[model samples]
Target: MFPIRDHNPSERTPYVTIGLIFANLVMFLLTMPWGLNAEGLWVYGALYAGAVTQGDMMWGLLTHMFLHAGLMHFAGNMLFLWIFGDNLEDQLGHLPFLGFYLICGLAAAAGQISAEPGSTIPMVGASGAIAGVMGGYLLLFPRARVDVLAIIVIIVKVFTLPAWVMLGVWFALQLMGGYTTPGDSGGVAYWAHSGGFVAGALLTLPVLLRKGGSRFWSRTDGHPPHDPIDYGHRSRVPQIPRR
Candidate 1:
């Protein structure tokens, strides 16, 4: 299951979120050939992407977020960012949101490294950073509705759920993944996701408190300050009577 959109609308344009999406896309284009070639991916990953290597910790912490193992990796991260990031940018503003994002990304990298300190595998992608965005969204708008598309077997279903339920389930899955999958084991970075989420929630706590803590929730009733936008309306296909 993946989020398709949110009911909450941003008060202002989410420039930072858009910029971030653009940057990730640009980076992917720049590194497209490397992603397409296995050997190239290794070389690019080793030199630039962050890895928990025995050698001195390099610039990968900063660079790794821009790299992705494949197109799906990049697309998935971008999708989450698009779906959840605007509200964060609305709450945190542009520059602060950018800072929060970087900090969460750093925390995410640290979380991964901590999980496997000696692994030479390069951890790439924006999953960790976007996970942070999800965390912030959970804390800020637990009652807001999110639209999710789930595919079970051959059936496709679209459901609307509260932000807490959506994000809570996502976090739980990450925790499970972290336990079952070894860190830096050439798959998902469950630790990074969990870590970034924690960091995002903690970092957003002060902001939430500043907004009057419980009062904020009470005032907004845990929903967005504005009315939810209904994006689920389906156009009916016209039927012609048999002639």
Candidate 2:
């Protein structure tokens, strides 16, 4: 299941979030086969655990957040960013939000490097940073309604759920994967995801406290500070007659 949209909408336009999405798309185009087709781009841009541990290619900590392994990876990460980024930007402001995103990305790289310092795998993608955005969103608006599309084989369903439930499940899966999967196996960077999430939430704690902490939650009722948008749609599934 993946979130399609959320009921919460930011009062101000999220320019930084839009800029990030555009930057990622541009980077994808530059690295794609039809574009530059430069294999060296991955070597230089993607984070290498060994290189970082050795104090070389330190740029990868930030560069890797803009690179992706494939179209699906790019699309999925961008989608999550789009869904969760705006409200955080609204809350954190433009420049601070950008800083928060980069720092979370760095923390994610560190998490992976700590997990597999000797691994030579090149980790790339904005998943870790966007996972941070999800973490922040969960803390600020846990009761916000998010529309999720669940696909199980031929069965399809769309449902609205609290933000806490969706993000909580996602975070749990990352922890489970991090524990179950070998660190050097080189598939999903589960530790990076988990670390970024925790970092994001921790970073957001100051803002939460500034807003009076529990009182803020009481005032907003764990939702956005404004009225939630209503798309006026409900879940539905089509049926097929058996032959």
Candidate 3:
């Protein structure tokens, strides 16, 4: 499901979120070439995927969050960040947002490494960290409406769903996938997705609590300060005659 923009709006642009997305894309492009496999494609995950077991390149725990394998990988990640990260930046401010994003990314890498303490495969991409942003979005704006583009077979549908349902389902899938496909050597670090999400949600708790917590939700009616906008359809399915 590709997320559509939220109906709620923020007072300020999510500058830090946009900058981080750009930074990740630029970093991936810069390092992607050097990490290509024999097939002349990028696969150098170790540059960011930590080698924690061997006690080396501890920095990859943080670096890995900015690295990605291909254009699709980078694009998908940045897209999500674009959709959901702004409100978070609005809440956390600039430096705090930067720190929060890094922490989530590093925590994501650490989760994958913990799952495969001795594996040599390098994990790459900003997905896990982005997952954190999604998690944080869930808490900050649970009632905010998200427009999702859903495609199946030859049919496409778009709708605005509650944030809890969208993110909740995504989080559930990660957990199931993590357990079902525990393949450290093969890539697709599901654990990182799972871990980063947990970290992001948990880490942001204190901030949520300080901001009047339940009271904030009560005051705002679980919505952001602005009203949602309707997204015109993105499809043109030909209408059929009445059967």
Query: Highest TM-score among the candidates is held by which one?
Result: 2
User: Model 3: per-residue lDDT, tens digit, 75-136?
Assistant: 88888888888888888888898899888988887788777777777677888888888888
Model 2, CA-based lDDT: 0.93
Question: Can you rank all candidates by TM-score, best first?
Answer: 2, 1, 3
Misplaced by over 4 Å in model 3 are 31-50, 230-243
Question: For residues 56-151, what per-residue lDDT tens digits would candidate 2 score against the true structure?
Answer: 998999999999988989999998999999999999999999999999998888888889998899999999998888889999999999999999
lDDT of each: 0.84, 0.93, 0.78
Error of 1 at 54 (Å): 4.4
Which regions of candidate 1 deviate over 4 angstroms? 34-57, 232-243
lDDT of 1: 0.84
Candidate 1 has what TM-score? 0.89
Q: What digit string (tens of lDDT, one per residue) describes model 1 on residues 176-207?
A: 99899855576788888999999999999999
Model 3 reaches what TM-score against the true structure? 0.86
Clashes in model 2: which pairs? Answer: none
Measured against the true structure, the TM-scores of the candidates, in listed sequence, are 0.89, 0.94, 0.86
